[model samples]
Target: MGGSYEDAIALLDTRRRVRRPSGALAKDAARDAGLKPEFRVGGEALRGKPGIVGMSGWMEELGHSPADVAALNIIHVAGTKGKGSTCAYIEALLLAHGAATGWPRSVGMYTSPHLLVPQERVRISGTAIDERGFAKYFFEVWERLFDGDTATESQKGERPRYLQLCVLVALHAFIKEGVGAVVLETHHGGEYDATNFVEKPVVTVVTPLGRDHVKQLGPGMKDIAWHKAGILKSGAVAISSAQEEGLEEVLRARAEERGVFGGDVKVVTGTEEPGVQGVKPDVQMGNCAVAVVAVRAFLERMRGEVLSEESVRRGVEGFKWPGRFQVVERGGGRERWWCDGAHNEMSIGVAGRWFVDGLEEGDRARVLVFSQISDSRDTEAVFRCLAESLKGSGVQLVIFTTYDPDQTFSASMSLDQQVATTTLPSLDVYERVWKELHPNAEVRFELQLAEALNLAKRIGEPGAGVDVLVTGSLHLVAGTLWWLGEGVGGAR
Candidate 1:
């Protein structure tokens, strides 16, 4: 009866009064408690979002079938720009107060578009998951979905996109590692994203809303806001940074449904406070402020108390998002490489301000290394913002490059995920934008980012003020780092 599939089914059929479900089905039953029978979308009593994980019930299955996420105290965040920075701050705050709170220092987080390395998406205690750990958990998640066998090369590519799988692994690894808390960052809309499957999180935070990801999310700001607010659930504390007029309206309306608006849990809009320590260096003051409040709320949820201001301040001071406006040393510490993931107009404007503000304070040869990461960043608009933001910075040279990972270095990232690090990126579209912005502007289109970096260093003068402003796609920052022999910690 137990030896063959037919015999087992025959035995069950003869003896069974009613079939009892277990494994994935039992886990799904457990998670069914959180689901509203009539699924709602943005406060509207909608029937369902067919593709969304909330309705699909995939998360419930993922939770118990292979790993359980029920006990993980997670701080979930979704936004356009500062999601990564905000998550970093939360992790830093947790690490800073780990000993005091008796919290596990193995802080876990999952972010997207790792600057140069893929494992950077899954960090543990402030470092990328090493190759061995990543491979172990990576295949564990992968194999679980495919009946416990290694995926072929073709099957691997056909699997979920790299970011989605990385998230699954991060959640799985965090559970296995016994991490006390997790900071989950979503790369897309709250309701529709794969990471949204997280059943329960102590806190959910959103940074300032922006107009990127229009194709997938929607055409308008409100649409984007509604999608982002999907992360909100009943009885969960929610926090947000200042939003534009349209963005605020939608977010507030949705938050109202959950009784989050105008409550202590919602907190004030992050714009009112210069909440983080010193000058905000990550992306914007609003984002840093939002992170501060969100981390405080998370700490309160985890430990039933808020961390001391000094501890929070110390974490904020030391926190740095790898490719977000980071000033790195290249060329034997002589040249300054200011790298940022200004892949869109909103971020480009900020990056331009940081660069121009620096140049104004002192005289330096500032070279602009820019490229379009995706169409989400309208090339024309991005170039226009850069042109206006850096109008008088005397940017002597502009280099447009790609983020092709294969050309730069052999990375150990699973699924052979590649960045546009080589010289083959389509530079003509961006070059055309540059030409229109500065018909007389000096520029170069290189297939290899490494060549572009070498060129920038060569074209600039040797002095403290010589800055190579490597601000465009975050992938470009990672490529530049790897090209300059940095970021080897993870990809290697």
Candidate 2:
């Protein structure tokens, strides 16, 4: 049953059934265990130790030693926002420079929370591994770890979690394919993320920091910064996007403590390089800046030369990271959809403003489709911020929906039942919060993403000249694209 790609996906899905503890139970357990009260985001509740402590042993079981993993020459990147886009820029830079650099390195990129399929997490030279290739590597690692007769000591007692398995499969694929350089994005934070097991990285990057993953990585911005800065080991060249106020101090201290290459973190101002033509929007300019600096450091370390401005221009011009600030036109461009995965408080406002700035001078109708499932973020605050940004845009309607496209609403069903069956909030908190900020605006609630998108499209019909902004969660954005028959091509 686990031989085919579909079967492998099913096998992977089975491992995702670990039940998260209830809020009260989790708080109590965290207190008793001397752990941060918010450190129970996933399967960590069932494990006795941090996940990172066991990563090396697991890699050894898969026939790769620590030295071999380090030889892959990874660029470890971690942050709350822009890490994925930054990685995309770095990948583009390497790809552009490969020809001039003698084509010496086969660049690989490993990112998480795929928009479509599991295979999207691993890519070689800009293309995702095909279904047959993904299945081959997935089964090899699965059998090696779970096979009763030949299982390693660590695996004989327990199997790797979903994310851990994904990392292993990616590393296995990269090694087997002889990938010379890798751009690795941290799934959560740096210190304990499974990808941090690569003790030696050629360069380490920390993009703009913010309060995200509060349940697992934070009680404050400084704590989150510490976790992100953990990837700065003694050997790597440490770099970071200009952090908010004191967070840069945290990163610098960490770099000094780790005895990193320069004994200090190089904070990059977005002005370090001239802006690329296609790289508009203030936020992406910062991401591009950080990528340029990181790539420069990587080139100097690996080839003893500075990165060429032409290569940077080419990479920035060619870079594409979908769902960040993506614009999709439907109904032959009359219905413009501005989609972004800005779930945190800061990013919400940034994305909202960007959407508003793109609006034309005419009396254009605006639509907003938003949903967020995580209880850890300030969903109400996000709504308020978004409402403030779109004040002058004349938003005709707002649709709040869940990420699942198959969900259906039934008034006959109890609210408790609805909450139990789907990812919708237990109450109408989001809608209420939004209304408080914009009493005159009309709002509707949909149980599924497909219905929300359909309702938005109808209200924003081609002749109406409407602009729609979909945000609040990556899952919501990805689900929107999937239901629209869009593929995870481009920069994601």
Candidate that scores best on lDDT:
2
Per-candidate clash tally: 11, 1
Off by over 4 Å in 1: 1-67, 149-161, 258-275, 331-333, 360-363, 405-440, 461-465, 488-492
Estimated TM-score for each candidate: 0.80, 0.89
| True-vs-predicted CA distance for residue 67, candidate 1, Å | 10
In angstroms, how far off is 159's CA in candidate 2? 1.8
Candidate 2: stretches off by over 4 Å: 20-48, 152-157, 275-278, 405-423
Report lDDT (Cα) of residue 110, candidate 2.
Answer: 93
Instruction: Encode model 2's per-residue lDDT on 258-335: one tens digit a residue.
Output: 999978888887465854435778888888888888888888898787678787887777676778898988767778
